[model samples]
Target: MTPPTPAIVTQSAVRPLPRWALLLLCIAYVVPGFVGRDPWKSADVTAFGYMLELAQQRTPWLAPLLGGMAPETEGLLPYWLGAWAIQITPSWLLSPEMAVRVPFAALLVITLMATWYGVYYLARSPGAQPVAFAFGGEANPPDYARAIADGALLALIACLGLAQLSHEVTSYLVQLSCTALLFFAVAAMPHRTVAPAIALVVGMLGLTLAGAPALATLLGVGSVVLVVLAPGSSTDRRLPWTLALAAITVVAALVAWKLDLWRWRIVGANSGGKEWQSLARLLLWFGWPAWPLALWTLWRWRKQIFSRQGHRHLLLPLWFSAVSIAATLTTQPADRALLLGLPALAALAAFALPTLRRSVGALIDWFTLLFFTVSALAIWVIWIAMQTGVPAKPAANVAKLAPGFVPQFSALALVVALAATAGWCVLVWWRASRDRAPIWKSLVLPAGGAALGWVLLMTLWLPLLDYARSYGPQVRAVQAVLGADPGCVQTVGLSRAQVAALQYHGNLTLERAGLQDECNWLVADMESWPASERMVNAARWERMAVVPRPTDKNDHLLVFRRAAR
Candidate 1:
């Protein structure tokens, strides 16, 4: 006998979150980080560099490179997308930096949409439906499913980790979006055929091209098994679809192999106690409220989860989440690996809403209110300190941390920040005073608060963050040292990001140190100097300046003026 579902909900509890509000929240979350920012640090800039290379026709499209080096992660599709965006966009409309981010922002939006639909379809499953009432006042299936899907979308936005990583122009975001598409495709299988089939193909192929061939293969294989064994699906009927999917999976793997994208990256065995502890900490904070809710969902829906007759609602998300968790444990970049699982985890979290007690919901609301309120307050206080220096400590701390940074006040930024803060206030009021009983009410504060903080940071703190995080300052310093027309500079031991920064910010022609070139200046990395020093004739070069990144004291670039000859 199938165990009874724990959800006991009336029509009132299934009240829909307003479409306008939901769309507004999504817009606020998706637009900020992508709009006005420099590509920060190792991953963002390195990826942008390849895109720029491709855009300028400086590197081969099939095999993108930066300063004669291939990308660290063998993903080609993201770079291609970015390059296409850059090439197609008019300079008057958007800068190359902003242009490259356009597609990625769309991907994040796609991830959100796919997650919502995935949860909606999963909730519509017969096993996942709320228990029917004898008196016949139960929530309508469509209404209940919509409410749950809204809650899942809110849960995804509420995840602390998604704000930053999803905004970056990297393969991870592509992989994440593709993963969500795959989740939706699988969940929507029983209802829709054409859309699901197209989604499956795109998702599998996207993952394979986005430096995650192994993950693509694993997810595809698992999904094929699920299709075959799905309780409601007949094996005979599903066989053709299963065979097609399996063949696509094999083709994806073969495509990866042909493109030379397969690389063995399993590094979990090397982790010690500290690494495990760090990963545990990451899980606790990164997944945030969603992780706890997912646990609750498993407990509440245990019977459905472990049923002999497979429950697609419980099993599909569980499989996706399990695979993501496994990848997180085994992969080199655990956070990016884990990002792929968030949509599934959010779906699981949404189901917990139907079973949550009023007290538990209240507790969640209160916690989110407190956490985000304090965080927003801190951001405002810091911005004030930066502008007026009324609070001396925060300003002093900023100066101490980011040496040589000049704080500039922007009226536009202030207006945007104030407006976002005011919107948050309105949202809080609507949640506390006007609205109650909606299943997604518990998550309103969390999602709103998250969007509030992100918008505030992107507006008020964007300049400071850009200075501290971006390599432009360092590159400018290097350029100042080089002066006008420092032609054909030779570079030794600079990382891909550093090279890209020089290329983009300084607009300098760079050649490798060993390359046959008549170059007047050579730049080298502080850390790589010792290894490369033996190859260069120290007598032939005079050290000019050690230009250091303002935020990092140890990261220095050594500029050398070739000895006058």
Candidate 2:
């Protein structure tokens, strides 16, 4: 090297991922925390809050109250984990909100890793490396293309949904992660013997934990299909039968267990039902804004459906998407349904990336940038309107901020940064095209866009969102009024929403007032306070304080201290 660097050595100099690209992707993955308010009002959040309280008391094995009232719900796994996190983390370091969410964040990270691995395998199977590397003639495709694709996949994992899910603790998040892992495992299994065996074990575990076996059954069937459809010789034929038998046995066992478990019903327990319309609506909501691209990609690749390369990675995503949609449609809540499509959409979106032209790609990039930028600005505008003593005209306000609020300047910065990165990407593509190396250019735009999107979301978008949703002031108000003693306070006719907010932000425990004499203090909504006739005659309670509603009168906090005590 000292004598004179060889031509090959000079040409092979390593190129690192651009600093700005890395920063953007990291921001996107982590930034949801910024915009997302804590899990204050959500039913799942309330359930976890109760669980965390139980765990804080060292009752890690027990399921906490469902919906902060019902005791009959199953699946104490998330609760146990939350409890464990609470126990290990320092008291000051953990808010009840943060305690429950730690698991979500950890699982999200795992999902990202699984996604990378899955995409790597999928890319390899499709001869993505070979196709990407192939020059105009007999020359080999550049090695950098493979590295770039891998990086782009990683960037996709650090998406907007990941941030939102990680901020809100929910079983759906866990199920999504498990689902991704299951598919990854299935897709990676090449051999007949290993594939079914692995699918059986992983499939069982995932279905059991996900609280959805029908979907798991679909996944198992799809895996078998993949095996049958695989292009190998006679050996592949025997694989499907073996896998089918094993899957049947496992699924049958799971169904039996589920039936027996559901026989004795408690409050808040899910009773299976049919809701086809809701399912359709859920699917529509989940697919919005991004569904068009996903659908386009699938349509274009329809011919590849039966091809050997296409079938290899197809079954898992298809089964997962189909079953998840079906199951969510049948269930009561639709939000959870969004999670089922994440893996499929992400993978499908990745496939579409390679096909987009430079102009088209730039348009998509700009659209996302503009979407976030406008969103951020809208939030600030709303805040300004609210602050400047604007009359509360719900209809007018709705008309004005039709779509919704946007983040502040800090939030808008994410969009600006993305636009800049996209500009750079166009330049890179232009350079590559000039050199007659368009294939290499494919990797550049996607990689740059993904990286930029990630950064914008994580750093600017998340922080702004979190700040907007935080209930720190509300927590402070409660604490100032009520002393720190857990035994002194009680909540009366409190909604689960209020209970969750108090539990998460204020570290307050709420107990139902069985008798008027049971409580020293009562926190209740003025509108819903029980009639005086319902009070026990001997015990006296008087309203001592009222915290005026910050945002709405319906939310005023009326505090009653014992007149007798």
Candidate 3:
């Protein structure tokens, strides 16, 4: 009753890629953003702020409080991990914020490794393997699977969304890593003996603690349903995954209960027209090349995907992607929510490889090569403009965008950019001239190019990005206005990010502005001036100055001084 698999691959089609090349690709993707940057605005600094606070023992670890307000995300483990990393880090080595990045960077690496192994295991399944040739010359199972796994990792690295968030020291990073681990565990369940069981329970529990209890539950339920409904597998073989799911459910409940992460955060209707449009854009660009291929896999493998057979190779990833898509629909900033699905998406994308024609692969290669070559050239040109001002336009754009920025030259940044460019050229040359036709060949350039762009940004444009994204300048400007030893600041209408910055960067104690609280200086956002005055009393406060982040003109930081009696 099961539909026959469409794959008809041969030995030549799935040659093993070099292991060293894969290692280099992963390093290129993982290492750049971890070093040499301040925590950029919004979530990055906000999360780092909480971690720094915990490291300083400023608040209870269970409920991290910043400027008398808890972080908006309802998760403790991520903050706890970052705080622990800070504590463990030797003071002689790096700043607490940078120290926290080390552990999360490891989590990113783990996510990549887990995704690779997951796809590898899934590809080893009987249905997933290519058809054996009549003369015994079909692609060797191990080599084919390894090649496909290689493609999956490349697909994951090539995704535009993975670069920034994967490097972040945040709860959601932990959530994403857990999702990848779940992918591995699910794929490895039938193949492995003990490791998959442990990974499943741990991954589910980790996801629950990392501010995504709903997503964790959905994943767990989906896995359970697939295993139960799968037609071919006997109950004995399915028992382990079922038990694993049940264990995940129980542990996840405990995590949600203990951590207080369970809350109704689904905002408004599931989606409106505007929301759908935003999501469409996110899906189109965020998943990029992977989305198109995943669609291809779903369409081309429809019989295998939907058939009653225990076609878990297709079913598992589809289930994961479907659940994540549903989760994305219901969440705000759907892109972040959609990030959880990417590892699965990448795996789905890899399956499209065996089915793709020679023409299609070459087309992909041509597009990737041209797109990334142009992109790398643009970054180099902008860097030159910023430094030497030969073109004048990029410099003008930089100045116009980030006011008060003084461009400083770094030989090391320049050297790294040059090396990345050189590596890109070599890669392109090899791809063009070489006669090799590995299944992962088309994706190699795309992943390498994505990594190249990120490394270039991190190295060459880090200062500009830091100035534009960081709250340091605004905080310092406020500090100057407040003067040395200015005492506690009473604040109103400030975002969590601003409050965190003031506490960490300015090193000033903050009191939430109110009618009863008395403080020498008050800081507030301009829009809330009337309410701030009403709360802290209009008669006692005098306006000092308005400070804005260099790039954003609309958002103003207002400072006030209290009058003497």
List model 2 lDDT by residue over 1-565, tens digit each. Answer: 1111101211122133455754455444544442334553345556566566676573335435523464323444455666677777787976655666667677776566566556545545433322222333322223333333344354344244444554556556656776776666665555334643554465456544535554555566666666565543256554655465456647645764764422221123235544555455656645543345456546655556544443554445556666665655454455565675676655655555445555765565456545544554444354444444244563355335332333344446546555655564564555445442332233344444434544544444443334334444455677777777746466766666566677667766566554644667778767666535454222466877776434343566777777854
TM-score of 1: 0.98
TM-score of 2: 0.70
Model 1: lDDT equals 0.91
lDDT of 3 by residue, 1-565 (tens): 6566667777887887778978987887898889988777889889988988899998998888987789888878899899999999898998888889898999999999999999998898877887767788778889888989999999999999899988888888899999998889888877786888878877898898888898888888888877776554668988867886877777897779777788987775444588678778888899888988999999888988766675878889888888778877887768788889999999999999888887888898899998988998898899889889968999999989998999889999889889888999989998888655677887888898998999899999999988988898889999999999988889988888888889888988898888777788999988877664557787888999999988888778999999877
The C-alpha RMSD of each candidate to the native structure, in angstroms, is 1.3, 8.8, 1.7
Which candidate comes out best when scored by lDDT? 1
Ten-residue segment with the worst summed lDDT in candidate 2? 1-10
TM-score of each: 0.98, 0.70, 0.96
How much lDDT does candidate 3 score? 0.86
The number of residue pairs in model 1 that clash at the backbone is: 0
Q: What order do candidates take by lDDT, descending?
A: 1, 3, 2
TM-score-superior candidate, 1 or 3 = 1
**What is the RMSD, in Å, between candidate 1 and the native fold over all Cα?**
1.3
